[model samples]
Target: MTEPLQHADHLLRAEGLECERDGRTLFSDLSFSIVPGTLTRVEGPNGSGKTTLLRILAGLNDNWSGQVYWCGQPRQKHWDLVRRNVLYLGHRPGIKMLLTPLENLQALVAGRQQVPGRVLGQALEQVGIGPWSHVPCGQLSAGQKRRVALARLLFADEPVWLLDEAFTALDVDAVAAVERLLEDRVRQGGAVVMTTHHEPAMQGMRRIRLGGAGEQGPVTRAVGEVD
Candidate 1:
């Protein structure tokens, strides 16, 4: 709405990002750019803080110290603009279990956009859970609950997506569906930064590997084989 905060090339960029949790140093001097039309995988062992890093990128965590630039400027100076253009999906489904699947989705897009009920239903259908849309999420299976969360991807208008293990618990079909969705978004000039154990079916994915020994810090690589 406000002409997208005037970016030269990158949609999001982090410079010298450093953070620690429980006194464990997660990363240091971590710099990267999330440009349009690319898929970035945050690769790391368990407890390596992939989720923590995603939170920082999405503005959900402020415990970290570093400069995150939204559209090539400091995040603090234009955080509101940053918030508007990014869609974040945490590892948890984040659905209100007491609410129906439809209701959960309604709440997701409520303040962000004026999505109609029919459109919302279509999103559920696209994710292969339309029949269960009216049923409470508490009654849904693990995979179904994940699908409900995945449904939001269908209608989310945000250009930047920060997904944490988004493919977990999904069936083969559902995983493929989400893969297609990611491909579509990237083709349309959107950027996605995600963490997943499942190897993505999509090609040309860059990776940021965390943990292990390095004189400088954890390694974040781009478009190449392991070094």
Candidate 2:
């Protein structure tokens, strides 16, 4: 049996995680814990199951067998609660090209936290896309579209963020803005788990590399201490 976590303050925990694709084992026996007010980065070479792990953590791909604990309890038992507090941003923009930036945000907002149009507009402005708020997402450049997708992070009230290659098309300024936003989230007692191949630009972030022949190891404080 896996040892019970010593730090009960963990916001996210995964134990004995296993994932398979096309009848081939991708990764197994993974475990990890994320504490509030911290940033955890998942790093590895290509085809290392970085995105797969993020999906499992976000409760999207449920084909795996393992246990996930949220806020010190079984995630399966409180899936709804976990869902409310977690935001998963994948490589795809996941935005509707036909909708304006504001409309896209309004459509994706969930739970009781409805961001007012003014606030959503402000978030877009912060991302340096205020001028394009009324423009259709399909008309925007790749980087602009990416920024629009990232704007969700600013307005969403979730306590945990899972991002896969979030910095893909961002410029230097946009990258700095994202780093600041994530920093603010951690300072507010929120937790973040992200997958990135490039060296993280954010300070005080913990990094863990994935990908191997055997079962992947659990995320530990040692991995989380990569500053």
Candidate 3:
């Protein structure tokens, strides 16, 4: 196997991040570092820059000004290296309606890594969509489609995950399952930075609140707060 670009000690770091949209400043001078084996949740009221922040971290939206580092190196210097290790799951399930769950999974991991068909089937089963693995995603309900998207987590080997409202269409049981999965990832030395309104039940999950009264700047919880 090829060696990883990131190490355990070298985590994600952002310095002096600033963003504005529609003439409104979303955030400025924001900074934070996410260490492996921990979860960082970005919180805020409506219209706050939670989504924008996640996108910036994922290198999806580059309108913001900041320096994002992966393993103490600039992202631009190692874009491919960083992108290979980071998985960005957006607010919507980026699934192709005409394709089956199996097909989607195959396409997603294509060129990155090779997986046997049985593994894909097992991953679908893990997410409770085993029987629908061969069915076109268009027939699945919203919750089911979300589950299909989440199935990526099962076979995903990325060290860092950026989830934006990932739990939106899930039911209570599914939500709990995802929470446990996230916690397990951290326990296994993976890092996650997500934006969600739902309070995470995972222990030691840090928080960043944006856009509140007297809180123009991002309010990051102290490291001591993780426990």
Candidate 4:
């Protein structure tokens, strides 16, 4: 894990964004800015392209037409900066089922930074899955697997986060824990953008709906055209 720059003001801006699939328009001319110390929730009905929006911001999807700026520069121009600072946790747990939580976390963070085994253990405990740290993830419950994947957040110091359905499969206590983690991150000047149907109980959060008024173009229109 590359240590992200601390106390840095981060910004992610999308302008004139539009997307289409199977001859249907999902959203168009959607623009928003994610500022430091704030959590922006992306919400909309199903097929509204919430996941696509996150992917576009994370530089994982190029099927859409828009301009994304990281900090004050185009994201494409500072790919290195975005890559090092952004942490994306998708809907599915990315851990290997065959590996134990300890091994999975270690493998995930190995290339980015050198984290001690002790730290990993502590993180697992924080997520309430410490007792199963040695068990193979395949045998873990859905919620447990989710917790195992979430443990990575404890060690991740990234300045920007993009999460998709992070609260799924989590119980009430686990939900509160995850919310606290996001709150702490925002308080520390990190920014977060996530998509979820459940309302986040945290303060100082903003909302952006993908299929809201003036956000989607007619399906007959061109996909990438600005106007």
Candidate 5:
């Protein structure tokens, strides 16, 4: 397991985040802190800008105004650090259709580190794609393609993860597998901020409900650390 970040505070924090689109306000004064060893669920009805909020936190969107801190430093000043360490998984499977799952994973960790083929294959097997690891991703079903993307979670050494609707195309068993992955990440002292409609069986995940009255995301815990 990867070691926890060395920070003495929240892994990531946002203050007074506000974003507007199409001449309408999506959310205002939103704030949250992602504590280590915890999962934060960004919840709201469709079109409430949960994805947008995540993008802002991940530094993928620049159209918003907010005070975002990474390891207690302003994110804008340390953008490279944030981008390098945080793994942002979008709603769609972000993989090349023409490449095999192994190839896609190779490209993902290309510049950072060299991984052995055996390790890559083990990651695919963990995600239930071992039987089709070498098949071109274009020929895989939707869930399989998502599994290809999900495999990166196994290779993640980052302290922070931003997942936008990662559960969208997964089946029951696959979703359960992801939940276990989340559990593992937290156990490794990582922080997770995700947007998903699926009610995870793992409990005590803090909720950030957008577009509601006074719903600015806060760092309040409903229970103790995840079991």
Candidate 6:
């Protein structure tokens, strides 16, 4: 007898979500579903609420109205569970300038399972900054700093990845490395959602655009038929 294939779980669902700041609507009536084994890109022009949507997905912006579901349940009903399953990386490379790249990785992964030095070295090599692993991040180039921040993704074991402009300051090789990492995650039944001004390099990914006078509502450009 042959074993049955396991279907990827729906990691996130947003329905009728509305966000506002100081009485100005950022986005409203936004709806989408993200499943494991896929990458969903949120693309739009400047001031179009891409970051706002990412925040809502990450549960960092709780003021929004409507529902966000995780694993088919309301996220609010199980905040801890949702948070544990998701990893959000913002536009800023959240690294301590004083710390070496290896030290920063050590601090971030200290409490979790031990991060092997070989794995850390491999991740740094993937981003083409392996040679500078011992250098303080403040002394590195802007692109190198960005790569150091991105190294956290490799150590994070979450199922969902939320990145805002992840490619910012990345060189060509770094961009390719990031894309490969994302593709590998999807292949292993992980989900990804990100905001980017430029289209991502990954193929078969979904794209959503936010529009309207106040960034109200989203229009799907290209997506998998079911999502």
Best by lDDT: 1
lDDT, candidate 2, residue 176? 79
Candidate 6 residue pairs that clash: none
Summarize candidate 5's per-residue lDDT along 111-146 as a digit string, tens digits.
Answer: 655778888899999888999988999999998989
Q: Provide the lowest-lDDT 10-residue window in model 2.
A: 213-222
Give the total clashing residue pairs for model 6: 0
Score candidate 4 by lDDT: 0.82
Clashing pairs in 4: 1-112, 1-113
Clashing pairs in 5: none
Tell me, by TM-score, which candidate is best. 1
Reference-based TM-score of each model: 0.92, 0.88, 0.91, 0.88, 0.89, 0.87
**Local accuracy of candidate 2 as per-residue lDDT tens digits, 1-227:** 33332434888888878787777666677777888778988877677688998898888898899898987799889887888878899998579999998888778774437778888889999888899999899998989989988988887777789999999988888887888888888787778898876676777887766665445543222265656
Residue 189 in candidate 5, Cα distance off native in Å = 0.7
lDDT (Cα, tens digit) per residue for candidate 4, span 1-227 = 54544544447888888887776677777777777787888777777788988888889888999888987788998898788778888887579999999999999888766899999999999898888999999999899999998898898977789999999999999999999999998888888898888898878677776653334443211122111
Question: In model 4, which regions exceed 4 Å deviation?
Answer: 1-10, 212-227
Segments of candidate 3 deviating more than 4 angstroms: 1-8, 212-224
Q: How many backbone clashes does candidate 2 have?
A: 2
Tens-digit per-residue lDDT, 1-227, candidate 6? 22322445567888888787776676677788888777888876777678888888888887889988987898879888777778888887568899989888778667544788888888787777789999898899888888887987886788789999999988887788788988898888778898876666677788776665433444434345323
Model 3 earns a TM-score of 0.91
- How much lDDT does each candidate structure score? 0.84, 0.80, 0.83, 0.82, 0.80, 0.78
Error of 4 at 194 (Å): 0.8
Cα RMSD of predicted structure 5: 3.7
lDDT of 1 by residue, 40-139 (tens): 8988878777898899999989899889898768888987788888999997857998999999998988888799999999988888888898889999
Residue-pair clashes per candidate: 0, 2, 0, 2, 0, 0
